[model samples]
Target chain A: MLNIIWPVFIIISFMYAIVTGRVNEVNNGIFEAVSDAVELSITFLGTICLWNGIMEIVKKTTLIQKLTKLLNPLVKVLFPDLKHSQKAKEEISMNMVANLLGLGNAATPLGLKAMKTMQEENCKKDTLSNAMAMFIVLNTASLQLIPTNVIAIRTSLNSANPTQIILPVWGATIIAAVVGVLATKLITKKIK
Target chain B: MVNYISAAAIPFIILGIIIYGLIEKNKVYDSFLEGAKEGIEIVFKMFPTLVGIFLAVGALRSSGVIELIVKIVEPMTKMLSIPSEIMPLALLRPISGSASMAVAVDIMKNYGVDTFVGLITSTIMGSTETTFYTIAIYTSAVGIKKTRGILVAALLADFAGMIASVIIWRIMSTSFC
Candidate 1:
C-alpha cells in the first residue's frame, strides 16, 4: 500500500514544482535550510553536553534507580514479554521520564540505549523487538506535558498566556501516548 | 510506593543523560558534527526539490490557485461541517509547520490563549512533529535509501493526532463546565 503511494506523492510534488517554474527558486532555500540546520545542531550539541552533567549527578544520587523501580509495574504492562530486570526497567523508565519532562534532548540517548539493551536481551537484528518498538513509538509520540518549545514560541510572539498551553499539551501527550501504545501493541501482536 | 520510587530518580535520570553524553564526548561531538555536516549536504540535496515545490505552492497560494482549490474543497468542508476557521489548517498543516504555527498563533492571540481555540492549536503543535523534516533527517541519517512504509505511517499518525486534538479540545472546553 505505502510502496506505491509515497513514491507517487514525491513525484507529484516534484512535478508540481517543475510545472510551476519554481525550480529556480531553490538557491535561497538551500542556503536557508543549511543555515537553519547548522544553527539547530550546535544548540542541540550544547544541550546534550549540559544535560549529561545533570544526569550524572542524578545517577550518583541513585535518582535513576528509584525512578526505574517506580515505573517497573507499568513497564511490565507495556512490555509484557520483557523480563523483569533492573537494567531494562531503568532504561525504559529513563526514556519515559525524559519524555514526560519535555526534554526530548534527554530522552533520545536513553531511547537509543534502551533499544540497544532490548536488542541484546531479545537477540534480534532483522526486526525490532516488541519492547523496543513500543518504546520507539512512545518516544516519537512524545508525551509532553509542559511543551517547552511551544511555550517559548508563545512567549517570543508576545502571547498573553504562554503558560496556558500546559493543560492542552498534557491532554495531547496523554492521549497520544495511550493511542500510540495501544496501536503499537496491536500491530506488534498481530505481526509477530 | 511506586510514585515514591520514580520521583526520587528524577535528578539522577537527568544526571545519566549528562554523564552518558560527556563520557562519550568524542563520539557525541563526532555525531553532532556529522549531523551538522550532513545537514548542510541535505540542504544542497533537498534544495532543488524543496524550492521547486515551495514556489509552486507559494504561487498557488499567492496567485489564488489555492483559493480555487479551497472553493473545490468547500463542499467537503460543508459535508464534514468543519468550521470555516479550521479550513486553513487543512491546507497548511501538511506542507509547512511554520506557516501553521503562524496561523495557530494568530488564533491564540485573538481568541485568548486560554480559550478552546488556543488549546486546540497547542494540542496540534504538541501532538504532531514537523513530519517531512523529521522523516528526511532521520531517514537520511540512517542511510535508508527507500523509507518504504515509514512515511505514510508517520503522516497518518500526524493526521490522526490533528483530528484527536480537535475532538479532545472540544470535549475539554465544554465538558469541564
Candidate 2:
C-alpha cells in the first residue's frame, strides 16, 4: 500500500509543480528534505535514548510482571483467545505499557513478539485471525498518557508550554482507542 | 497547576524507575547504556525511511498540492471548526510520521507555536499513530498475507483521533486562555 502511495506522491508533486510554475520551489524542497530528516532524527535521538534507558532499568525490575498482572483483565477482554496463552499475554501487556508511555520505538519489538506469539496459536498461519485484528487495532490506536515525542519537538521549538497538549492528547487517543476497538469488534463479527 | 504536574511527571517517572532498579538489585547504569545504544541504532535505522517520506511530503507541500487540498476541504474544516492550515497534517499523518512531524514543525514556524493551529497540529501528531506504517510492519512481521479489517479499523481510529484533537483543543483553549 505504502509502496504505491509514496511514489505517487513524488510523481504528483512533480507534475503539479511544473504546471503551477513552482518547479524551483519543488527543487528546493527536495534538496532541503534530506537535511530535515537528519535534523529531526538527531533531535529525537537524545530523548529516545533517555527514555529507552529508563525503560531498560524498569525492565530489569519486576515492573513488567506487575504491569502484566494489572492489565491482565483488560487484555483478557480484548484478546479473549489469548486468555490461555501466557506468553502472548505478557508480550501484549508489555507492548501496551510501552505504547501508553509513548515509547513507540520500544513498543515495536514487543508488538512483533505479541503478533508472532498469536500467530503460533492461529489455525491459519497466512491469514489474520480475529485476535490479531483486535491486537492491531489496539496497538495502532494505543492510548498514550504522555506524548513525549511531541512534547520534545515543542520544547525544541522553544514553546513556552511544551506539555500543555498532554491533556488534549490523552483525550484524543482515548477516543481513538475506543473507536478502534468498537470497529474491530463489529467488523470481525460481521466477517464471521 | 495541571501543566506543572504533568511537566513534573517525566522526572518522577525517571526517579521511580531508578529506585525500582536499585531495589531489584539490577545493574541500572549498564542496562541504560545497552538501551541507549539500541536507541541510537533505531535512529539510524529510521533515517532512510524518514528521508524518503520527507522528500515526498516536501514535494507535495511545495508543489501546491497542500494548498489545493486546503481549498477543496476548507468548507468542511470550517464547519467543523478546524483551521484549514492543519488539513495537510491531518491528511499525511496516518501515512507517515516523519512527514507529519515536518508539517507540524512548518505550521509552528509559520503560525506562532502558541496559536490554535499549532497547538492542534501538535495534539493531532501526539494522538494518532502512523497507521499505514504500523500496519505494514506488523502484518509483515507475522507473515500475514491478508489484513482483513485491520486497515479500516485503524483508519477509523485515526480519523476519530484527528477530530477529537480539534474538539479537545477547542474546549481546553478556553481554559488556558
TM-score of each: 0.58, 0.85
- How many clashing residue pairs, candidate 2? 0
Return the TM-score for candidate 1, rounded to 2 decimals: 0.58
lDDT of each: 0.54, 0.83
User: What digit string (tens of lDDT, one per residue) describes model 1 on residues A25-85?
Assistant: 4434334444543443343333334433343333334444556577777888888767756
Query: lDDT tens string, model 2, B11-116?
Result: 7878987988999899999999988887788667767877887788789888999789889998998998789998878787888776677667767756877788
Candidate 1 residue lDDT tens string, B1-177:
323432344455445554665664434444444434533443344344334334333434433434555688778766764434455554455455555554554455445666666667766776666556544543343233433334444455565666677777666556667
The DockQ score of candidate 1 comes to: 0.14
- Interface RMSD against the true structure, candidate 1: 9.3
Q: Where's the lowest-lDDT run of ten residues in candidate 1 chain B?
A: B139-148
Pick the DockQ winner. 2
lDDT of 2 by residue, A83-157 (tens): 679899889899998787666767899999999999999998888888889988887785687776677677766
